[model samples]
Target: MDTFHFHLHGDVQPLDRFFQNCIGSCHAYLTLREDWREHARLIQREIGFRAVRSHGIFHDLVGIYQIPWGGERVFNFQNLDKIYDFWLSIGLKPFVELSFTPRALASGDRTVFHYQANVTPPKDRGEWELLIRTFATHLIERYGLEEVQTWYFEVWNEPDLQGIFWTGSMEEYFDLYALTARTLKAVHPSLKVGGPATSRNMWVKEMLDYCAAHNVPIDFLSTHHYCADAAFEMGEFSGIHWRGQKAMLHDVQRTVQTVRQSAFPNLPVLYTEWNVSPIHEDVYGKDSEFTAAFVLQTVKDLSGLLEAYSYWAISDVFEESGPGLTPFSGKYGLVNLHGIKKPVYHAFHFLSQLYDEELVSDAPSLRVTRSPEGNVRLLTWNFVEPVNPDFHSDYPLSGGEREEEIVLEGLQGEYEITCYQVDREHGNAFRAWLAMGSPQYLTAAQVEQLKQTAEPSVCDHQRLILDGTLRIKHVLPPSGIRFYDIRRVG
Candidate 1:
């Protein structure tokens, strides 16, 4: 093998939970009522995330009593204590989205697609504001204001998109955002308030402008993204590359640049609603495993460029009803609707384990590996399975069989390298699940069984020495992701 650059030391810290839709949505879709206990237990014990972005609130397309939009299944969160209990019991901090106007408050003519979104401002702002107060009061009464305040309060979903997400204007959004922000701040000034959660970089500009002109408080910013290609469908992938991966980070990069240019240099940008939409295409069955590795790489590569990023959803929710879904509602997710963990979920778990710092040992040529010294715990996974951007589609993607090496340079002397890999044989339970076919769904019990069995097996490979270094060589597995736990044994 060849040497790369920079010795890696300290580990990277884990970000909070990645946001998704309703907890009830995931619960219903994932658990067979009987297995709810085991399902909740297994999921809660899973060390991946401590937070979740519950989707489809405040947008007014869905009612408060009903399951929020995005969830295909209609669930009544009417028993506030019941709903809150479920989440708290599972050990989750809600990234609350102040959302879709309830039908009762919606303007007579205002309503959107499947969600029946009421984009029009409430006919009675007082009533609507009261509703907000009520919700907050309930949460505080249940979870305590101090506890609930720990949650995020994003004003609304993407209002910048005219047709689908937003029927309101920038000015309207500013008004809504300001009102929501003030309400939250007034209720508990320490509560975080930042949103205008629009898509593909829409609200950043207007949001900043509004906050600046109006002097509103923004704790953190949130947004969303998807692969830039829309031409293909259902596995028709042909020419897709990890370049889009770069594009993912680049979008944040540009946002960061622009923010710095505009004097909001310290503003943190959060990718709140991303991944393949409609909740099925990008993730699900067989196509989502190798994305496991991509998950690690993408997050690691983009960590510096973003403050926080969520992978749209944890599991596919019930809002995926075709009857109500518009032209392109089939988005992607890290996991699927079955409650079984996707490769991406596993990878996310792995990435989350990385400590908050990265230190690379200074190495020779080959820009891949970092120096062996430092406090960072290095976790680099190679996706033997190409991370085709058209990841979930039915067509062939831009990656093919190939050979590559990442040299860890700048080793002072001998070092102990432990490696763990997830591939067809190790962590590819999805492959087995896929064989079960579409109608194939796992009960929470079955899902739990799989989770218990989903541990990675490690093997020791040959070691080489050069200029005070050690090299490990092995064939990267098919659709495999190899993680190196590099430590100094000298």
Candidate 2:
């Protein structure tokens, strides 16, 4: 049995930048798809993401680069116009990841992802600078300078990874960034831009030093992290290394500390991509209670460390490798291909409901916040990452139940208590699918049934009369999360 003690405090703390609101996708081209757009809108309405970041805006798929008949090479904004317009329509600003060398501008044929975006360096740096300036100018013209200025213009994605995402050396990437950043800033100084968007939280120091040395503009620092033990080797689906939540938090803190000690101490840090496991093929665990717990734990730990953190994806419409075969194909998404909310989706949704007024708690597993309207919300979770014998298992390890006696002090009057929960048996679509015999193909009826099972189960409302303190007992299974909303009534 575990004990958690919480006290309601009169002191109010500013709400930390909870990174649940910024999310990412595989490619900018996907934003043009009807299904993708539908899912994006659903995420915006449900999860409330403010900005979306994705790769391959300048890739050939978006058709931004061309050498027309007898005319010099020029930029095209047709597809870009459609994509940005759709994002704006959905109330999401772009965290534009300027990436993937366009084929026409590439010096070599190196490429990545299922879409084969050219990953080689530009054939002409001068032309690259011109392209960037023209692109920025076009965005300002179409979206208005005031509006476009608010969006992020990241130089490139994961340039420090070596040989995989980038075909050039580290020095070359810095040069590329300088050209891109300088050109964009030259177009409009207020247009925010930054990058070296390296994977596994790399290259912050080097990027900062280079930018400072070269006198390049850096409005914010951008990078990514995954809880996986190591980088995923190319051409392999090695499953998840599963480093767990504590390790992920340590890395995030280290990254933040590195920036704080750097030449640009006040520069904001944005985690352009993140997830529990970077492996996109671990379908079973990816959609399970374990992943949901990981999400809750990581977000709580990252409370004040980031300006924004975009989850790797919002929907499984992603196709970096290829289209997912099943509804729960372990692709990186908060929702499945059928658009059913997974347990992790509910985790974030519940997190979004937390208020600005923070309360003191002795338990590391509990987060307490009070609304300005005198409502109190308590979020608690039991997170246990799979290890040793259970690490290779497709399903989450079960039966680590925690019984906690929660004592809340400094409370008076009658209050209404509403609890929303997610565990192996609730708000978990993967578990529901398993109970349905792990169906590879779900029928319409089966899908509808799973949708119902995927929702967060609500406990019956209870009224409590508190003279000075309140006590409640909760039993949570492994990777279970419970959110309690308590409001005073007459």
Q: In each prediction, how many residue pairs overlap at the backbone (N, C-alpha, C within less than 3 A)?
A: 69, 1
Report lDDT per candidate: 0.54, 0.82
Question: Model 2: per-residue lDDT, tens digit, 53-156?
Answer: 88999998898998766778877889999998999898899889998898888999878889998888998988898889888888888889889988999988
Top TM-score prediction, candidate number: 2
Per-residue accuracy of model 1 over 234-268 as CA lDDT, tens digit each: 22333433335456667777777766765466887
In model 1, the worst 10-residue window by lDDT is 363-372
Superposition error at 365 for model 2 (Å): 1.5
Q: Which pairs in model 2 have colliding backbones?
A: 283-330
